[model samples]
Target: MDAADAMAYLFSPQGRVDPYPAYERLRAHGPVVEIAPGLYVATGYAAIDEVLRDPRYEVTHEELTQHPVAGWAESPAVASLTGSMLRANPPDHGRMRQLVAGAFTPRRVAAMRDVVTAQATALVAEMARRGRDGATLDVMDEFAYPLPIGVICALLGVPEADREAFRGWTVDFAAVLEPEISDAELAVADRGAVALRDYFRDLVEARRRAPADDLTTALVQAHDAEAGRLTGDELLANLVILLAAGFETTTNLLGNGLVVLLRHPRHAAALRDDPALAGEYVEELLRIDSPVQVTSRKATVPVTPGGVPVPAGGRVLLLLGAGNRDPERFAEPSRFDPTRPHNQPLSFGGGPHYCLGAALARLEAQVAFPLLLRELPGLALAGEPRHRTRLTLRGYATLPVTVDADQHHRVVVPVPAGERGTPTGAGSGTP
Candidate 1:
């Protein structure tokens, strides 16, 4: 198929489960190819990296709002949430990022390792208990999805009772991140945005009156200190941004990571043997199947990426997952090698807008994966997995697995063998 036709196929639902072949076709056409008017797609490592790091390429919400795309930029709710740092460029992005950076410091995230591990352990234990009678387990529901959401909710001071309500918001907000959308989907996204804003508005007020030792409280303090810096609306929007960005993205990572490991039994076996390799495994997973597949930037000046000229005001979509598998940068790029050195994938992105919660996400994975492998020895896909409909934040809608009795026996207590027990530099954010 031609590049355009291939890209169309890449976005088709039939291709959602496996887009690698389509990506290869697009990459072969050129590192940078114009997908449509004012839109360019970059696939190769060099081009994707350059675009990500280029200052002239901006991520302004206004750009998205002005785009002809339906639902995403057009929806009022989507526009409000995207106005956060994720879509801001330069100074504004820098300001919002700095405000939240202290909580996501390497020291802070490192300190969270224990809490993350404990959560994963409990979830896996529950799964084992529930599946004891040969009952199939939905990994996404039982483990992968809830782990990150629960952690993020705890960090944000969201009550467990209210989690179910917020989970719907998470799904709604995530729909806006896609390249394509429908009117019905936009309405759902709008409802999600409104529900989330109302929920956080009350929560923020409660935190203001009775401040807690949580990120929400910190954000409140930050807003008060820098009065004109962040409006009340901005504060709510930022919180929604954090919830949507933090929860859904990490869910994909965990789900995709497990899928990759299951497909590569040797790597899964190695992880089961040496838990310390969890860090390496997380990096490999990020490269092999990045959760955040595509990020867009608007060019401020005419520039050339991989010999393709992009005019000022042009939109550039960086295919991060495709770049992670570029053979020119990674030897045998398609292979899943946990031990691969210098495996710097564009999964967490780069440059000024690099993901602020990356450290926390990595910490979550480092703690979650090893504990999962140790807890569920015979864990295997229960059935054919189903991918989510969204193309941008590529992930599975459901991942069902079956765990055996041996896996059930592994989670009898809080302390697993060889586990340090103590939270390592708990919440220190050292990395």
Candidate 2:
């Protein structure tokens, strides 16, 4: 297919299954291709990297608000989403990022290592119990979903009991990120946004009254009257942002990583042999198939990406998945090599708006993957893994697998009294 066809396929349902070939086709056409009126897609690594890190490129929040589509601008989900750093620009973005920066410091993330280990261990132990003797289990629900959610909820001081309800709210909240969400989905998204906003409001008030040693408490108690750093609206919006973005990235990372390992049995065995290589293996897995596929930025002034000038306010869709596998940047880009040198993928993005919780996501994957491999050595796919119908966020909706510890390590553990059986539904990703 030609460039236009490839670009079209990249956004199509079939493309979501595997977009790498389409990406290569588009990149061969040009570094930057105008897919539609005032809409460009950057295919190559250098062009995408430049566009993402350039100061002249801005977020599309203002344009979105001015030109509402699907009536999302009037929806509560859009309101909550646009109020945070993801869509913010300039002074507001800087201020909002600074306020939460303290809570996600290296020291803070490092301190959560034990927590991540314990959670991963508990989940794996439970999965072992459920899937013993080759019994089938959905890895996405039992292991990948709960590990990150539990960690994020604990950090945010969200009550453990309410996480089940949060899963439904988060799925709707995340629909706001879709490029073409239907009216029916918009209604669900609005309800979720309003519910999430109100929930955080009560939580914020509670934290203010009874300060605790958690990120929520830190945010609620944090104030500089002289500097005027945090406002009530900003606080609520950011709290919602944290709740979604915090867990979403890691959840997809864990799910995607496991799928890759399953496909490459040799690599899985290697990782199981040496768990310390998880850091490298996770990076390669992220590059081979990014969790967040596409992100956009508007031109604040005339700027040229790949020598193609984009006028002010023109939107540029940065195909992060394409850039990650660009031949110019990565040799044999399609091959999944954990030992690939100089592997700098744009999975977490770059520049001013780089993901704030990147380190935490990395930490989660590093801790969880090894634990999973070591505990379930005979783990293998039981059926076809199903992908979620989303372009922005890519992950498995269901990862059915069976564990046979007859030849490998055996983990026969009893499930806790309160958490014995499987959850009812598949989990969702936010942000």
Candidate 3:
């Protein structure tokens, strides 16, 4: 397909399912190519890196979205999301980000290691139990989604029983996040956003009434700090953002990583034997097939990315997935090599707005993958994998997998007595 056709197809429902070939074609046009009148796409790694590190580029704020749906400004969800640190620029972004960073501390993440491992162990056990009779199981529903959800809920002080309710609400809320949205999808997003906003508001009030030792309580304390560091809308919006992001991306990571493992059983065995290798494996896994594929930015003034001019207010869709696979950046980019040296993917973005939950997300995958392979020795894809129909957040909706206790791959090795135990899963983020 030509550049225009490629861009159009990338966002189409069918093309969105697998946009790798289109990405390769876009890069052939140049690092940054104008796909539409005022919209450009950055496919090359260097181009994306430069645009990300440049202060001239800013996140596409609500004003730049140009959503023609009536009453978009009145949307509580949109208002909350846009007001949050994620999309805000400069002073406001810095302020809210500081407060959030203070609450979401490194110590908090360190403490979750035990919680994550326990959760992963239990979930893997449940998967083994359910599929012991040779029954097919949706790993996305049973394993991938639950691990991160359980972890984030625990971190936020949410009740365990209330975990399942978020599945539909988050799914509905994610509609507005797509590259394009229909009026019907907008309506669904609005309703879901309203529900989420109210839920967080109620939770905040409860935390205020009786403080607890969780991220929510920590944020509540931060919000109550002197000088009014975080506004009420900022608090609610970030709460929704945190909850939504905490599990969604990790769910994708787990699902995507599992597919990679099942496809290449040797790597799974390597990780199972020496769990420490998970860090390297996860990095490669993300580089080859990232969880979050696209993010947008608008030029505040005339600027150029990869020597391509972008007028003021011009929008650029950064194809992160494409950048990860750029042949210029990676030798035989299509090949998945876990032992690659000096490997770093633009999966989480760069500069001031880098994903705060990045380290935590890596830790979760690192810990979860080893145990998953060891525990479910005969796990295999039972049916065709079904992907979530969106380019922004690329992942599987239903990964049909079966645990074959009898048929074992040569790669499934027995772990040492001292090295064996239930594993873990936890964390959240954008990429």
Candidate 4:
């Protein structure tokens, strides 16, 4: 297939489940190819990496606002969302990122290890309990989805009771990110944004009245009275972005990681034998199947990537997932080797816009995977998995798994006064 044909197939719903073949075709074309009149696509590792790190490339909301697309970047709702750091350039992006960087320090993420472990363990236990009567478990519902949502909710001081509504809002908001979205989808996104604004408005008011020790409160306090670092709309847009990006991306990571492991039984067995192998497994999973597949940047000046020239004011789509599996950069890129060396994946894009939640996502996966192996040794897919109807943020809508309860004993660990406990006793079980 040519570049344009490949782009069409890659963004189509049918390709959501597996876009590798299309990605391979795109990469084979060249380092960069114009998919359309003003759009360029980069699939090679070097090309994608260069664009991600290049100072000439910018991610501005103005590009979206100016686009003629019906569903994406065309109204007041889109304008309100431009306040977020993801849509801002240099100084604004730098300042917003720095303000939140302190909260995601290595020490802070390390300290959250116990919390992640406990949350994953609890979810597994609950899944086991619910499945005790021979019921099949939906991995997405039982484990992958809830864990990150709970974690982000706790971090943001959002109540657990509000999680369901928040999840709906997240779904609608994320739908707007896909390429070639429909007007119906945009209307849903608009409604979601309005609802979220109202929700955060009340949340901020409450925090103002009774300051709490959470990220939301910190963000509120960070806004100096005279300087006005963030306005009410900006805070709401950011909170919405955080809630959606934080939960949805990590949820997909865990789901995709597990799918990869199951397909490569050897890797899964290795992880079972050595729980410490989780760090490597997580990294390899990120390389093989990243949650965020595509990221876009607008060229401020004419630039050449992979020897292909991109004109100024043009849009460049970086296929991060494709770059992660480029044969030039990785030996046997298609193979899912847990122990791959020099595995610097572009899963988390490079430069200033790199994912702020990378550390937390890694911690969640590191804790979740081992606990899953321990809880259900014979955990296997019950049926074919279904992918979410999203091209940008790829993930499973449902993953049915059957747990062989007879092969493993259920272990209950206590939640300490201030912390949570880890699972104990590692042994072999029938696969």
TM-score of each: 0.90, 0.90, 0.91, 0.91
Candidate 2, pairs of clashing residues = none
Model 3 misplacement above 4 A: 63-67, 407-431
**CA deviation > 4 Å runs, candidate 4:** 62-67, 71-77, 405-431
Each prediction's RMSD to truth: 7.4, 8.0, 6.6, 7.1
> Candidate 1, which segments miss by more than 4 Å at Cα?
62-74, 405-431
Q: Residues 1-431, candidate 3, lDDT per residue (tens digit)?
A: 68988887777788788888789789889999997778898999999988888999898754323346666677665776697887889988898788667545688777778888999999999999998877889999988899999988887888888889887888788777776666777788888888888888899999999999888887888888755788788888988888888888888889987886776656677787888888888998898789888888889999989899999989998999999988888876776668767789998889888887877788789879998889988788786788888787789988887787674332332322322223222211110
Compose the digit string of candidate 2's lDDT tens values, residues 271-298.
7888878888889878988988878889
Flag the better candidate by lDDT, 2 or 4.
2
Model 1: what TM-score? Answer: 0.90
TM accuracy, model 4: 0.91
In terms of TM-score, the best-performing candidate is 3
Native-vs-model 4 lDDT? 0.78
Best by lDDT: 3
**For all candidates, what are the clash counts?**
13, 0, 1, 0
Task: Evaluate candidate 4 by giving its C-alpha RMSD to the native, one decimal.
Answer: 7.1
Candidate lDDT scores, in order, read 0.79, 0.80, 0.80, 0.78
What TM-score, to 2 decimals, does candidate 3 have?
Answer: 0.91
